[model samples]
Target chain A: MAATMNDVAQRAGVSVKTVSNVVNGYPHIRETTRARVLAAIEELDYQLNVAARNLRTGRTGIIALAVPELSLPYFAELADSVIQAADAQGLTVLIEQTGSRRERELEVLSGARRHLTDGLLFSPLALGDGDEQLLDVDFPMVLLGERLFPDTVDHVTMQNVEGARAATEHLLGLGRRRVAVVGVHPGEVVGSAGLRLTGYRQALEAAGVPWDESLLGEAGLWHRSTGASAMAHLLDSGAAPDAVFAMNDAMALGVLHELQVRGIRVPDDVAVIGFDAVDEGEYSNPSLTTVDPGREQIAETAVRLLVEQIADKRGTHRPRRVYADFRILERRSTLPA
Target chain B: MAATMNDVAQRAGVSVKTVSNVVNGYPHIRETTRARVLAAIEELDYQLNVAARNLRTGRTGIIALAVPELSLPYFAELADSVIQAADAQGLTVLIEQTGSRRERELEVLSGARRHLTDGLLFSPLALGDGDEQLLDVDFPMVLLGERLFPDTVDHVTMQNVEGARAATEHLLGLGRRRVAVVGVHPGEVVGSAGLRLTGYRQALEAAGVPWDESLLGEAGLWHRSTGASAMAHLLDSGAAPDAVFAMNDAMALGVLHELQVRGIRVPDDVAVIGFDAVDEGEYSNPSLTTVDPGREQIAETAVRLLVEQIADKRGTHRPRRVYADFRILERRSTLPA
Candidate 1:
């Protein structure tokens, strides 16, 4: 049987309340008593039952992180960083995959599982501006990604537009006209794709290059296969682009692969750049030039904000929006040197 | 205030027990009564309190997945597959990062937080065979990766040896006599690295090639940076090999990057192969030839076994060791054609 508070108390020849006070770090306990209780607890190898303690304090010391998918390198890296940051705070993370489905995301918001976690770190890919009212939950939550809701909940977001603009400008500065973009979600106006598209257009306009509809490659899901197919379609249409900007590194990788398969040399024939400085980009053939969206900073800030919110018993703090910085990581894909 | 069973019962004009039975999908309820109860539930937007239910029944419908790290592409993809497979069975996964530390891995085994999870899907990188006694925990757990125990718990493993042998033979078939290996863990005997090294040696013997000690590159961590460093060390030490096999895809990618940096042409100068057919391999420049260790299958089977163990009221099942099949994916890295 697992050791109990009573067992520790008996071992220490003290009252259960005294042992509890010691365990809870009560300041009133004498150093000698605390040491005795600790030694007893150590001898028994007692682990305080977190679930049972949660019932009393209403805090499980667990934070739920809901992401679209871990298969995506971006989210995977983000998760890794979050877990690391949370570990520093002595908290464990519980991951939930919503599969970027509206129904599933909604379920996560309304589900009773919310009580099992101290707070939630939600990165909603499917929930849009229309679902803003759902953010008004009783529990603590910090929103992630580009979906900007009303300032009713804390949000940690990447500088999507700024990052994309930098990437597009890098390609345009390479003296390449007719720049094409892959992973343009059709009719998207508020998500990462839409924001990046706006940035791309802004860069093109600044470079005195007119936006061409023929240069846009439509992609619903930003998977490698989708990126490959989109690149193939762009090539088949005979609308040659001197430069290409894939929204993310995965798609950028696909574009590079497709170009290689078609005997088109990167940077020489078509300069390419991408967003999300995933580790995979560093080793891709020719390497990838990408916008590093300060993923570690974002993860750290989100965890810090969420932990603060969880500890705020008064619940009087207003929601705040924070954004991470971005920088272009130049590599061989965009520049030969 | 959230609606309770009593509120639902009163709204449906039925008893609380009947309402609970209806909510629990009791088949004996009449169609009219079920409809009325469901309507009441809908009207109240009632959600089942999983925490309250867990307190009563000690089941949270949440399984914990303890992996070494999510930053590694292999573990991230494996986690993705496990989450997908669990979702299909209506189970949610909680991820715990052990950071590949032995103390952390042991802490996970004895942690109080384990009570919050129905079972654990543990993928240990730090804990070795000597820690087998720790597997005697009361909770249901399915072991993943190597580090086999004495049949104390269910284990899901990949065919590391066979897969490595096939990869080596593929390079040998290309008439490459000297094949260098990357990501060899020092003093490993039964782990994935050790098993793969054994397979490499077996293939060398089968092909009548001599094993050179200098050809082995030691890597403490099977990460891309480590892979690059190991490859660089090999190159600087003048250990020239016609082909290279990295223990995992991340390391292979690093090797490829290093070779490119050194102006060495892949598949022409030194053929490269990797284990673990991660998605990154598919889009890598020259692409990557790798062993597909049936990751999805392993995940599905692990989840199935875990779920079964969770529901095993009799607790009569014996520990089973299951291996997933492996197939060599012929990509551009191994063969130019």
Candidate 2:
């Protein structure tokens, strides 16, 4: 049989609670005591049965990150950052892909799987305002992405409106007019697409450029294929805008590919800008100009908030909302020189 | 109090074993009994404590997938496929990123965290022959990627050598000589880079072409930046080849970006091909020609094998090896017209 906490405590001549404090990384343990406990554990080759400990203490040292999909570069990069941040906190992340389905999102919230992890970081793409009450669960959860529910859960989100406005202003500042927007979800007022479209309108109004409904290209999903189809629709309809701002880098890439297929020179015929400064954007054909929404910061903040909630066994802490700063990353796509 | 198996059994007018079978998703249970037990469970809102169930039966209904990183498009896509495959089996996946570190890989093998999941699908990049013995663990683990260990764990891998050879042959068949290979790891004999390099050499020899040492561009990591730097080194050293074969799609993208920066027209000045037919390859400037190594099939096969191992509680099954088929995807990068 493997050595237990009692064995380690006896070997180190310390109390079982002390040994547990060291094992659980309870931060306040003394250096010499921690060293002695560690030495005893090493001497006995004691492997803590995480499942049993979790059953006893209700802390698994694992957090679940529920995202729409990892195949999407945005979520993949976000997951990477979250994992790195969680690792720094001596925690591991269990990824749950909801497939952007409302039922799956709801299932993730109320499923028995919640008992397996201490906290959840949820980024829902499909669940809307109607499901806001679903966030009122017993577990600790930090909401991510553009979806917002007031006074319900802790939220770490990007400045979607400000970032999109900045991206449009950057394109307009480059002496380009008649800016077209790709990835606009018509009638959406709260989601990412709608919020970003509002920002685009704000930038256009600030620059004294009238908002043309024909310049708004609709996309159901913020994917590359959707971006390509939107760009195709704009070009085929002869609503040729001098500038185009895609909702995200994935869509921007599609727009670039479609433009290239049409032999249109970027920054020469039509300048392009995107949101989400994904790694692939740096290596894209024209090296995509995009908005850095401080994804790493958002990830770190969200993990920190979730960890705090998990640690707060009393459940007295109030929900908080934090927004990551955003900046425009100027690249070859918008700048010729 | 929440409903226990006994409570569910009593409420459903069935035996405890029948309720257990229904709750465990046993296929042999009668439809009427299943409905009664499910109805009782819903009436009581009984949430099965996964931690307690895991402690009792030693089954967490969770499988872990340990990969190098998800930020890499290849692994991200593989993870997506794995999740889909696992979901079909009514199992959830917990992802662990090893960051391709040997110590971390070893930690994952021996860590107490192993008890938290039913099985593991490991894809180690840094571990090699010296660590093959580590595969002799008590838990069920299925190995993925090019890292192979004989007579040990079950492996589901892509045809690295054959795929690379076909990629090279495709480039050669395009009437191109002096093919420069990018993303070669010097002194590697067993990993993906070395095996792919061997295939490149075999293709050159088969085509009556001599192996040129200068044509090999060494990269420690198979990333886009490495590919770009390797391309730049080849261009600066005046060892310009008519064709370039990147070990993976990420590096191929880098090669394309670098080639474009040098004002070099693809297929006219230089033809390019890459391995791993990732989604991004289709949207690249010239639409990357690549070797599709059957990644989705590998994921599905690996998950199925892992599930089988998990179901074989008696430890009666022997280790097996499986390889997915590979094919070359022809695109505009290799054929200008």
Candidate 3:
């Protein structure tokens, strides 16, 4: 018979949970306790096979992450961090792409297919306010990103509003009273764009500057091309603000590309800033000054929370929302006072 | 009463293997035979509740891909394509990260975790010559990438050697005799760097140019930082090569950035090229000239092969080696003489 975690725990006079914690490399556990657990395992010659142990817990030792796509480096890096977190917990990750379509997102929730995996980390893109029914899903799910649905579920979001406010205020502090906002959707009250837009408005009002509708460049999809085209539209309309703030880094890149193409020097002619501390943002032509939303932290927290839920299958914890921090990284794109 | 595959085969006057082939989507099968099998399945309403159908097949309706890491855009996008291709064939993919470690790569092939999936698509980074025994494991497996181990398994490889030859020859054709190579090891005999170096030598010989060992810059890890560091080293050594070829696009981007930092213009001062057709490569400052090794074809072929192995328990016609095509994408990074 194979030696089990219980055998090691018994030999060491410690609980089975302590052995598990040691094997998992939990950050909070004491080094002495971990040493003791390792010694006991050596004495017992116990092999801590995660798959075998998880089988007893009725888990496949696997977790699934359903995201819009990995073609976008933002989601790609996020998935990488999530996989790292899961791997530390001895859980393998299975990724599924739903194309951000609401129907497809809902199908993954339905769990009609094989449920060999323990839970899902979902990031829904094309889902909208009307799809609130998906919130009542029974399976363990951790929703990522800033799209708040009507139904209740565990969600992880960035400090979009606060971050956006900082971005706008930075331009204002640079004495750019007339600042252009890229990647905006008018009259919207939720989502990352809407929340960031509200923050932008709050910043302008707080700074005693009037909000001009002409300075609000609405780019329907928050992509690089949209940013470039919207910047072109803003420049063509003669609403030349002193500075610009794009809601996301990709848009910021598009804006930077457009400015460079039109022979306009960044910061000197038009200061530019973006949201999301994307790696590409750091290496952009002028190195964009942007908001660094804590993407990795959110990914790690979501995985830990899911593992907790999986461990305590019947435990009742109210569905909670976690908001990660955001910081402004001032690089070359933005003008300094 | 539930009907079995054998019953369907008997009723349709076909061999059991033929019935299995029809069910698994073998491309070589005749259309009429497929129709006859479909007719039998319809007569029985053979629902594809693969979840319940294969309790006895001892195979999970899942395929696993073990990659070194997803932090690299090449691996990330490769995993994405693999997942999409798997989905098209009505299969799910479980991705395991090896962190490019030898131990983790071997752990993934242990075959003890049998209940989770039916087949595996493995991409090993650190597995050396001694680990060739892994190829003989008793499971449905498909190896991917440029690393060629002892041959006892189904393998899919990108055109690393030939693609490198073409890239080197292209640069040489532009009258660049003294060329530098980034993301290379001094004497690596295994994996991509070694194979591509061989191809580079072949191109140099074919062009009647002597291979200068000084031209090979050391990049232990083919990452962006390594590329930047390698370029810096090359420049500081006062041996300015006319052109540079980095192994992959991300590292190439790093080279491009370093060149810009030193006030060296691209395609004019020193032309540069890279492999891997990443989206960012297309949108780089001057765009990137690189090889588009058939990533999509690899995904489709791997998934199709894995699905066949899963549906065929007897393991007939197990594809040994699958080679995909490679194409050169002409962009602003490389210019013609």
Candidate 4:
């Protein structure tokens, strides 16, 4: 059997309460007593039974990551980065594949396993502005995304507007007008795609280029196949955009594939740019010019913030919004340079 | 606040002890009492506190998937498959990245979370025959991979030997006598590579072809870079192998890249085959001929066995050594169909 607190206490010539106090970092334990308990614990290689301790302290060194889907490389990459960050902090992640379900998100939040995790890092796809009640959850949580804008909870977001703006500006600076936006969320104006759409419009307005509704290609799923189909639609309309801005790298890759298939020269007939610098973007046929959303940094920051909040009382820390930087990662698909 | 057991008991018009007995699924409880307790639970949406339940029943529906690394696509895919299988059975996974460190793997097994999981699915890379004590852990676990052969534990493995034999046989059937093996591990005769290496040797012996150690390429890592370097080493040795069999797809991709760099046509110049049908293999330039080790089947089988063992203590179930079927996926990189 594994060594127990009673065993350690007996070995150290101390009471079980004294050993518990030392383990919990209580202030009253004498230095000698603490040392004796520590030595006994070390000698036995005692691992505090988190299951038992969680009953009293109500904390498990586990966290949940609710993401849209892992089949998509972007979310997969983000999950990887987040897991790495969590590993560095000596925590484990319970990944929940939401499959873009709002009900599932709520279910996961209220599951009995919530007691098994210190906090949750939720990335919502279906939950929107009206779901502010999620912020009122008593457990420690860090929100991640552009979909929901509750003011009471901590959120880690990227500069989607600015990043999309830079992507569009990059295409326009190359003297390409009539740019088509791929993977748009219909009607919504705050999600990742919606914000990028706004940034696209802003860029066109700044460049004295009219934002044509015809140039917007609606894609419910930001996948490579969708990007390809959207590009096919845009090309079939004969309203040839001088460039294309795919909201994500997967879609951008699809667009590139479609262009290559139809004998259309990239950067000659149409320049292309994408967002969320995926690793696959670096290995595409001609490579892809995209925006780096600072995924790695955001992951690390979110973990650090959630860990801090988890280690404190509910009202002890003020909720703060952290916005990571976005940069234009210029590659082969945009201009000749 | 969440509804309490007292509230549930009052709502069901039963004693709290009776309610507890019903909630805990006491075999002696009447059907009417059980129905009322369940109805009350549903009405209140009262999810049981798993932490408390764990202390009473000593079973947590969580399992740990201790993998070598997630940065590798293979591990990531394996994790995804494992989670899917586990979720279907109403279980959650707590992922731990061991980075192939034996200490980390053993630490995770012996950690406090051992009480938090129903069992463990351990994939050890560094822990060899010497770490046999792991099989002695006082908990239920299903081992994955060929790193261990302890008769005391249940092991779910792929047809590495037979699959490698088939792959080498496929290359030889293509009239290629000189087949080089990439990612040859050192002093190992029990892991995947070791088993596959044995298969390769068996195939050579059966074919009346001499086994040449000179064609062996050492790759410490089963990654693309390692594959590429190993292929280069083969080329630099002045003996040009007619075919190459990479132990895994990542290494196979690297070999393909090296061939491309050297203007050597795949299949035409040298037939290439890989093991572990990673998704990327299907999309490679010439595509890739690899062995499908039935990863999905392996995952599902392991999960079913674990959940069965958890639900029933007739625990006298025989320890199973399941070797999944392997198939040679014919792609353009191999001999013409």
| Fnat per candidate | 0.72, 0.79, 0.34, 0.34
Candidate 1 per-residue lDDT, tens place, A234-284, comes to 999998988899998889889999998898988899988988899888888
Superposition error at B236 for model 2 (Å): 0.7
Ranking of all candidate structures by their TM-score, best first: 1, 2, 4, 3
Candidate 2 error regions (>4 Å): A1-40, B1-22, B25-39
Ranking according to lDDT, highest score first: 2, 1, 4, 3
- Candidate 3 Cα errors over 4 Å, as ranges: A1-58, A236-238, A335-337, B1-55, B316-319
Candidate 2 clash pair list: none
Which tens-of-lDDT digit does each residue in B80-191 have in candidate 3?
Answer: 8998898888788888888888788778887544456778999888886777877687678888988887667888888888999999988888889888888887667778
- Cα deviation of A331 in candidate 1 (Å)? 1.3
The first chain of model 2 has a TM-score of 0.92
For model 1, residues B239-262, the per-residue Cα lDDT tens digits are: 998899999999999999899889
Worst 10 residues of 4 chain A by lDDT: A278-287
lDDT, residue A104, model 3: 84
lDDT of 4 by residue, B139-229 (tens): 6778886564767777888888899999999999999999999989977888888989989999999999998988898898787778988
Pairs that collide, model 4: none
Candidate 3 per-residue C-alpha lDDT over A183-220 given as tens digits, one digit per residue, 9 for 90 to 100: 88776777777899988999999999998999999987
Each candidate's lDDT (Cα)?
0.89, 0.90, 0.81, 0.83
The per-residue C-alpha lDDT of model 3 at residue A180 equals: 95
Clashing pairs in 3: none
